[model samples]
Target: MQEYAVIVAGGSGSRMKSDIPKQFHTVNGLPVIMHTIRAFRNYSADLHIILVLPEIQFLFWENLCDTYQFKERYQLVSGGSTRFHSVKNGLSSIDAVEGYVAVHDGVRPVISKEVIAASFFTAAEFGSAVASVPLKESIRSIDPNLGNRALDRTHFRLVQTPQTFRLPWMLDAFSVDYQEHFTDCASVLEEKGYPIQLIDGAYENIKITTPEDLKWAETYLAL
Candidate 1:
């Protein structure tokens, strides 16, 4: 079966305090989104990449591609008002009946090729898979009436992306009415009664949202 990656990069740099979008920020010499795109490309040379970006940022991305001489091929889709809609738009570019699709955050530039392969292959066999890591910190639940209460962290795993699924499964799941709790593709699938398979993800597969995350990406790339 064929493979595809839909990279969602609709951020506006509010958290990073930059004039430019965070995904367009440089991690080393390359733009952060470039690194992310390369990760999927390196995993499978034939993988079709669909980059979902806010409509306003299309010109900036085009200029960056030219400046860096980015030669990898990809289809660009206009982002929507919400992440859910953005992903739905990207899925429109894919063949729903014949492939596997992985939904990824564009700021997560450090996802290893091995993890990428595992996600796609696992989804091919089991229908769906989501990358996740064990939680290392304590967990707590806060409510105004109940105050704060510590919960067992062992029961939780921090979810990451490249959430892979059979193309038809994901395409159908996205057809439902948008819910506020659909934070990730897995959440959308789970709501539709699809079982999710969680696989080990690299700890370094961090999403760069704030200045501190950019610092970490810089240091990691430098090393």
Candidate 2:
């Protein structure tokens, strides 16, 4: 089936304390967002790529693309105030209602092509497939009244991106008014009564929100 990837990159790098957004930061002499786009492009050369970024950052991103001699094709969309709206904008770029769409984090460049393929294949079969990994460390349930108690970590999974879904279903899911609880496409689809399918994702698939994450990605890519 035809596929598309909507890569959202709205980070301002506050946690990384960088002047530029974390997605624009360089890893292994290449921008993080570029690596992310490459992941999808490498997965399927024919897949349509939609990049969502703040309007103000478009020129800068384009200049970076030129500087790196990055020639992979993608349609750029202006980002929204929040991730929900940003993804909505990206989804709107795809004219076709048939096929599958994978919403990914642009800062997460360390994802494997295997996971990318699984996401599309599973989403094609199940309507939606959200990439995730089990929490390795201990977990806890916190409440102001009840204080903190150890909770079963096995029951919880750290949600990652490449949240692939059927194109028509994803478009319909984003048509509703934005909700605060819509943290990911999976959550938004779940609100629309779509069952969320969790797929195995590598632990290396970490979002580059901080300097340490960038370092980790660089190290991972080098190995």
Candidate 3:
């Protein structure tokens, strides 16, 4: 089956306290988004890449690619005000009616090739799949009116992306009434009663959002 990767790079790095978007920030002298694109490309050279970026940052992304000699031919989609809307915009650019489509965060460049392939194969077999890592730290639930309370960690899974789904199923999910609660594409499907199979996700596949994350990314690249 055909496959595609949608890299969502629309977020502003407000938490990073930088004027540039986090995805545009450099790690080992390459943009974080470029590293993310390369990870997918390394996994599957034939996979079509669709990059979703904010309207204001479109020129910057293009210029960055040109300056760096990034060779992939990725279709650019103008992102919306929210992550869900940004994904919808990217989904609209794809003409594929069948096969698997994986939506990944552009700032998460450390996702291993194994996880990428695993998620794709799982989605191809099960129709929908999400990459997730089990919580290692102690779990807790906090009452808004009271203080924090320890809870069971068995029920919790830290979801990461490269969330894969059948193209038709994802399209249908987006057509429904949108909500702010839809944090990821999988959530959108879950709202529509679609069962999402989970695969092991790497803890290293962290999205760079803060200065600390950027620093960590640089150190990661150094390894």
Candidate 4:
């Protein structure tokens, strides 16, 4: 069986308040996306990486790769109008009959190799592995009739990426009509009656969406 990672990145830097896309932004002397790719590459040299980016950003990404001398190999695919569609496009490029694929956010550049390994191992054993973390702060829900009220934080987990699944399940799940509620790979798989096996994920696996996140990733890398 083979291993694959579909890295989806479509940041436009609206949150980061930059003219440059967040994925192309530099962190610790390397592009954020490069750190993300290296995280998985360090996990397994044989892991086949599938990079999903907007069609317009292909040349820009390539130029970054060249300027940085990024030698890691990855198959590039054009993203769709939405993140859901972008992920589906990435998954559709895989031709493997039997294997596991981990869908990850390319802006999350600090995912540990341990978590990446555990995702594949758990997915192979249980057919699905969705990385998540327990929340530390109190939370609440808001509605017109119900209004805001405190809820038990222990009952919920903050879902993170490398939402891994069997290759066949991934291909089949994305084949359905794109639903508005399909927020991530886990949602699509859950809709198809698959159990979501939650695994511990590091808080350091934060998505890089703002300047603070960039600074945090830089600090983490330096440590």
Candidate 5:
């Protein structure tokens, strides 16, 4: 079955204290988004890519692609006000009926090829599959006023990406009207009564949001 990746790159760098968007920021001399696109491309050269960019930054990304000679077969879609909306817009750009779609964060450049292939394979077999990693630290629920609250760690799992789904199933989920609470594609599906399965995701698949994250990403590249 055909596999397509919808890479969402609509985050602003407000937390990073930068005027530029986080995806455009440099990670070891290459743009963060470039690395992400490259990662998927490396895994499957024939895999189709669809990029979702914030309206204001669309021209910037286009120009960067040209300047860096990063030519690949892909389509660009305008992002929305929120991450959920952005993903929805990207999903709309895809016309494939069969196969699978892997929705991923554009800033997460370190996702391994093995994880990408495995996630796609699982999603193709199962109806839906999400990449996740086990929590490494002690779990705690903290309240601003109450301090720490007891919570079960066994019941929780850290969700990562690329969250893979059958194209038809995902398109059906996105067909519903948008809501403020729709945080991710998986949440949208869950609200529609679809069961999501979890797959092992690499801890190194971190999304770069802040300046500190960029620094650590640079260090990660050195190792």
Candidate 6:
């Protein structure tokens, strides 16, 4: 069986307050998305990588690759309007009929090799695996009518990506119509009655969405 990592990057950088997309921003002198790609490349030299980006960003990416002299090999696919649609587009380009596919956030450049390896091996055994972390903050459920209500924070976990799944299972799940509620691959798999296996994720594996997140990523790089 083969392994593939589908990295979805479609940010407009509005939150990061940059003219460039957040994924293209430099962190520790390298593009954030390049760090993400290197993580997967280091994890499995044989693993096929697919980068999903908006069609308009292809030329920009190409220019950057040349400027940086980035010679890593990977396939590029055009993203769709939504994350769900973008992932579906990435999945469609996969040729492996039987294997594992990890749907990861392209901006999450700090993913550890341990988490990536664990998720892949665990998914091989369980058919589905999602990287997650325990919540550190107090929790509450808020309702427009009822205001707010306390809940057991211990029972909840902050879900992250590199949501690994058996290729066939994920391919079938993506075949369904897109739903606004499908925030991640785990949600899509859950909707199809698949049991989600939760694996511990790295705290540093934060999605780069804001300027603060970029700062944090820079801090992590220094550490």
lDDT of 3 by residue, 62-151 (tens): 799899999876788899888888889988998878878999999999888899999989998898889999999998788999989998
Scored by CA lDDT, what does every candidate get?
0.92, 0.91, 0.89, 0.93, 0.87, 0.94
Query: Where is model 1 more than 4 Å wrong at Cα?
Result: none
Provide the lDDT at 43 for model 5. Answer: 93
User: Predictions ranked by lDDT, top down?
Assistant: 6, 4, 1, 2, 3, 5
All candidates: TM-score: 0.97, 0.98, 0.96, 0.98, 0.93, 0.98
The per-prediction tally of clashing pairs is 0, 0, 0, 0, 0, 0
lDDT of 2 by residue, 62-113 (tens): 8998899999999999999999999999988888869899999998999899
The C-alpha RMSD in Å for every predicted model, in order, reads: 1.0, 0.8, 1.2, 0.9, 1.7, 0.8
Error of 3 at 193 (Å): 0.7
- Write candidate 4's Cα lDDT for 44-116 as tens digits: 9899999999999999988888899999988999999988899989878888778999999999999999999
TM-score of 5: 0.93
Write model 1 residue lDDT over 32-61, tens digit each, in one string: 999999988988889999999999899999
Report the error of model 2 at residue 130, Å.
Answer: 0.5
Full-model lDDT, candidate 3: 0.89
Screening candidate 6 with a backbone cut-off below 3 angstroms (N, C-alpha, C), the clashing residue pairs are none
Kindly report which residue stretches of model 3 are placed more than 4 angstroms away from their true locations once superposed.
Answer: 145-147
